[model samples]
Target chain A: MTNISRRDLLKSSAVTAAGATAGLTGIASASNHGKHNHSKSKRVVIVGGGIGGATAAQYLKKMDSDIDVTLIEANKNYHTCFMSNEVIGGVRPMDSIEFNYDKLAEKGIKVVFGSVINIDPDKQRVITKDNKVFSYDRAIVSPGIDFKYDEIEGYSKEVSETSIPHAWKAGPQTAMLLKQLQEMKDGGTFVIVTPPNPFRCPPGPYERASLVAAYFKKHKPNSKVVILDPKEKFSKFGLFMDGWKRHYGYGTDKSIITWIGKEAGGTVSKVDVATKTVTAEAGEFKADVLNIIPPQKAGPIAFETDLVGDLDWCSVDHKTFESTIHKNIHVIGDASIASPMPKSGYSANSQAKVCAAAIASSLNGVPMPDPSWVNTCYSIIAPKDGVSVAMVYAYKDGKIIKVKGSGGLTGPYNAEDRKREELYAHSWFNNITADIFG
Target chain B: MKQTKLILIGSALLASSTFINLAHATVIDRATILANTCAGCHGPNGISNGPLTPSIAGLPKNYISESMYDFATGKRPSTVMQRIAKGYTDADIKALSDYFSKLPKKATEPKKTNNHHGHNH
Candidate 1:
């Protein structure tokens, strides 16, 4: 061998070291070294134990036994967003929607009872409000949705402290609304203002209205409910209308429910808090009780972590549910920008499974399997009368897209099918709660 | 003549898979086949060096299949065992399941090594 400079020797040694490292990966000898570069097992930390986060933890554990995973949430219990409407309508108690994380902890997962206040993607670290800093190889954020208080005038979180309540997040406020409605007189009007598009649970408000009407017919027959909505039509509206007609004498002078769409100026222009009257595009509507579902975005933790973009939703790689902004950090649920997939608990649960599978693959340095998701949203026009629309979704052309020919809407306002759907809805809730929590 | 040619192509393809199976990764389903390879690190009778490696004796056959299938399907990620299992056929997995199920649970002393990773159940 010819004599080489010391500096040259150092450079050659560095190259050799890198080559040796590459060879251990099992794909270093291939011509296209850049195509696939596998790494070692990674530690994945997921924030939020709601439907999405919990489901992801289960899936990831099922996928990989070696990956170290930790799930963090502010609350130990999660109230199901899908069924929370029934809680507010007094059909189901708040306990009906609540679920614990004990099942997840039993599955060899480390469940952290703390609020994630900050996420530094560059460092791959998550900082809790209590100052517990955790470094992770990958992280998933699914904090769910929050109401935009400013969009509705004089309707702030503080305002809801006493007089008016949004009850959008679906906890104490939900029970408060139901209690307020129960105290209203027989002939008094209960005004509900539906917010604009891009809100949680697209079918939520209608379900709330239907359940509340069911209660009114039983307790106070003369009480009337008016739904001022921004959208002209809604999911399962035809079914809801049919149920309303059958149960509450809708579409006549003796109707117990009145739903005015944007065309009829149903969308509220402003809320005058002192008078307890809402000024809509139609006119000022006075009420004994007001339930305003304001425009919503991702929850506060998601915004605090810088996971949201210009659209007030987290940007994610549709295929893996991994965040596009923060490397190795994934976002799912209502907070994630997954188009064609509505922000429903079922969608969140489904996305969680796909995310779990992907996380396992990335952590193990293996090939990620193709992912597909299923979502079914069930609503009750009455306790025993229900309707739902179910769909299967898949990623196509680099984004989450609905799988055509896989799902269809409920049939045109049928009574028998609606009744069957209600039974199925309750069963679906139990199965989903068990699937995510149990 | 074209039909004959197509038939020849299909027959060749079928014959090649048979040849590949025999040579590429021969599946060992018989007790004798697994007794030699797996028993070296694991126990001859399905016991292990300790809790460091899981005791596979008397495990459910379906659970064994699912565990092996998960390893094969990339659903359950592993490091060393993943590569070790890459060669196991479905039949071999079933056979291993049978062998492990028939064996009794026995324990042995843990081997001292450089890596100190261990979780006590």
Candidate 2:
């Protein structure tokens, strides 16, 4: 057996080149647009243009050339929330994380820029804010996530716009938060209030805290970061804590970072915008910079369409991601009740592929295949110091469960290993973006 | 009694034939769906033209299957392949191996130079 190292596999540029070429050429050769040879044509309408929606559109066309895909998105451009923390930390610019639908359009998908106001399941149609109606044989919805601002007293959409910025959706708020962090003085305290469980990106709050700490370490050495989290445990807790101890002097009296869990009354109940103070169960704390990540639910579109039932998330069959409540409609990504799969960009992309395959198989009059999924989340503790967790899942016993002995976390902290993980993180960003858009 | 035995044998044959026909009619193309997932990263038909991901088309079935099993079991380490390998069952690994092995081996030429700007959207 030939043995290959992770570093060697990453350095194989020939393989990378072949993969890239195959992605683009494969799409072009598979799709025969403007050819009316098929006896019947199928229409697929997709809502939201994030990773999940965009991937589903592309894969649907590639799977069946004759299917008409119309993707309706509210914005002309989509700013990814995946790497926005880097923008706050001053590593990547905001424009670098922005995407457009020109690639989807080039793939013969009808990219419509409009808001979907309602969905008629019986009629199999979706209505837009502009009063336009689109009928489809199958509909896929991937509206990302929406915040519940009322959960935090004195925090509302208006406050998020003016004073506090969640920066969760990666738009103007992202820019505002970056400005706030950059302007703080030395020895200043930056307080980050993490939301409750089942939010987008489980390790996101910690990663943001790490990046902010990294920023202070370089620009203002005296500054410190305080993370108020509601959850007792988080994804990759041990790995993150280890890195924090080695780099940020965590657990020391003069540590640059302090993390308080729920047992210590870490959950914040109210925010005072005027005083820049957050009231937690334990006590009140003031900060030079305050970031409140409010509680979350499925995006508004899902609620408006009545796709979400009593559970704030849309119920779906783990096998095909088809909605259990509504026929001819499927939900993927963060909006669906896809547990055991943290709502990360990679997870959404993988789910979209499975949903696309199931939809195509249904339209082609074939049985759906038993589906498997893969997800890996990479967190950058500091520049060139990274860590990750990965898992593989399968549909079993009417639910998606992690495959036994399939995935694992990165081993103990080593400078060389961390640096390699960082490299892999960068390459992943490049490869995945290309795979989805092009 | 003799006539009843003949009728029972005929009924059993008819039922078996019907089952076979149903199986033939509804057979799921597991290999095709599985291949589509691989195409997302490796490229169509396992021939990638990208710079970092390898092309796995037209390799020997044993070679591909053994490599995947190694990745799944952590005998061979990779940044991404290990995660992907863990998602599959042994049956799936073998099926993918056999499917790709039968295709004629051909090298895919790179489509573009190193342009890391925004995707060609």
Candidate 3:
């Protein structure tokens, strides 16, 4: 059938029946539908309920409550990856970082707790694992990163689950890693293997090392935290180094943290799980608690469908974040290739707003508004020491460009300033969570 | 392709005249777009739940723009805002101020609920 004829058929049936209309709006609402209120509402289906999807869902309703928004998520409870490091550090409890969709449901968005198996762009339908299908005029995919376990020899998803916990995702793995940390004997070594570039939360591994060192300082003063990094430098590198020097006594024999960069042979070659040892160019290092954060790619759903044809991540137009490969499907968050924008929760939240605005504007048959984006990643190094990197982005030429003379790292170290940044970090947590899940 | 063409035309229109100067740009939606990016830390509509940040909602346009200018120019000693304010143009600041100045004065009190669930251990 021709595209126009199929839409006409859906519209004719939609006008006759009011009950079976919400799911049929994507097909029926293209042309005028004879003054029927149900047919006038455009349906937008959003997959994945993390920062990006949830924010898009909330903001879409906020912009036009008349548009139908449905959010499909695999897990009922969401533990934000942004602050999961704090949970692992034993500073904040796991429950504080965890949230449910009750608030979003209270708002007008339809919240479905199930895994989506397929998104048929041709048919404009998202099918869940349970065989239920949802149709939409536009679809937003915010599937966060998935690990490339095979990139690291002797490492797999099963290995990450049972033994060396990545704790990258915030749920059970976080708890598991925390348990391992607590159980390790005093003076034992805790090793962390970090991933290469283009991973979710670029500054995360360093922040993880810092907080873990802090935890050791209080609990096991003699214990050491070793970081094997694949990159020469990391996000907020100077600030992290400064914090390490002040708090952890870094660069001394008594230092609690040791970072081995790729230039110093920090790249991992294999992991001997039986011996709890990691082999790198530096040599095999045995550990009491090992963490292997493998290289990453777009979430499996992006690969399962045709969203990412030849690339590891989806290519999107910065203006609207619509997938260049597939029409009407917008990919945001870590799954999309939005360079100059780090894969932080703040970036996802920022991108979500732009995507929501674009989708809303398109559905209303109006010219899409120009977009502006902002992202600030705050890392708490110690209990009261924090640092950050921030940027404001604009759509220029054909890309999102960081505004010149704006955005920078935490300036030259002052104890009072670092403490204040810590407070701001906490405040940011409260505000962003409220913005997304509140 | 159709959407891309429209966006190009929109850019062309924006490039040709007073529209390039965002401070005087009359399209009201531009202000909202600039302001929405602030919702991450400032709370939605600039109504902050504060102990660290202030509620900028419903403030006078002059006060808001002046504060941003101060932050941008280092006249205001700030933790993060100093760096953030530098990113915006004078026109962007004007648009943000104009946007925030119109919001309601209502602010939700910072919630102090102890929502700690059980430890998995």
Q: What TM-score against the true fold does each predicted structure earn? A: 0.72, 0.82, 0.88
| Residue B91 C-alpha lDDT in model 3 | 83
| Residues A1-438, model 1: lDDT tens digits | 113432354345445544453322221111111233433324678888887888778666655544567899888777777777787677687897888989888888889999888898887788888888777778988888888888777788887867788777767777778788988888888888988878788888888888888888888888888999999998877778887888788999998899999999998868889878988889999988898888888988778878776668888998788888777889999999887888888788778767776665554444554456666777887866766766656567897766554454556655554555564466556656666777
Stretches off by above 4 angstroms in model 1 are A1-38, A413-415, B1-121
Q: How close is candidate 2 to the true structure, as a TM-score?
A: 0.82
Report the poorest 10 consecutive residues by lDDT, candidate 3 chain B: B19-28
Ranking by lDDT: 3, 2, 1
Ranking by TM-score: 3, 2, 1
lDDT for each residue of candidate 2 in B17-59, tens digit (9 for 90 to 100): 3111111111236775565556545555566545545556787
DockQ of each: 0.02, 0.10, 0.20
Interface CA RMSD, all predictions: 19.6, 16.5, 12.0
Per-residue lDDT of candidate 2, residues A299-327 (tens digit): 99899888888878899998888999999
Candidate 1 per-residue C-alpha lDDT over B1-121 given as tens digits, one digit per residue, 9 for 90 to 100: 1000101123344333311111111111233223323432233344544323344667787876777767555566432233345445466678767767766554443343212332110
lDDT scores for all predictions? 0.69, 0.77, 0.82
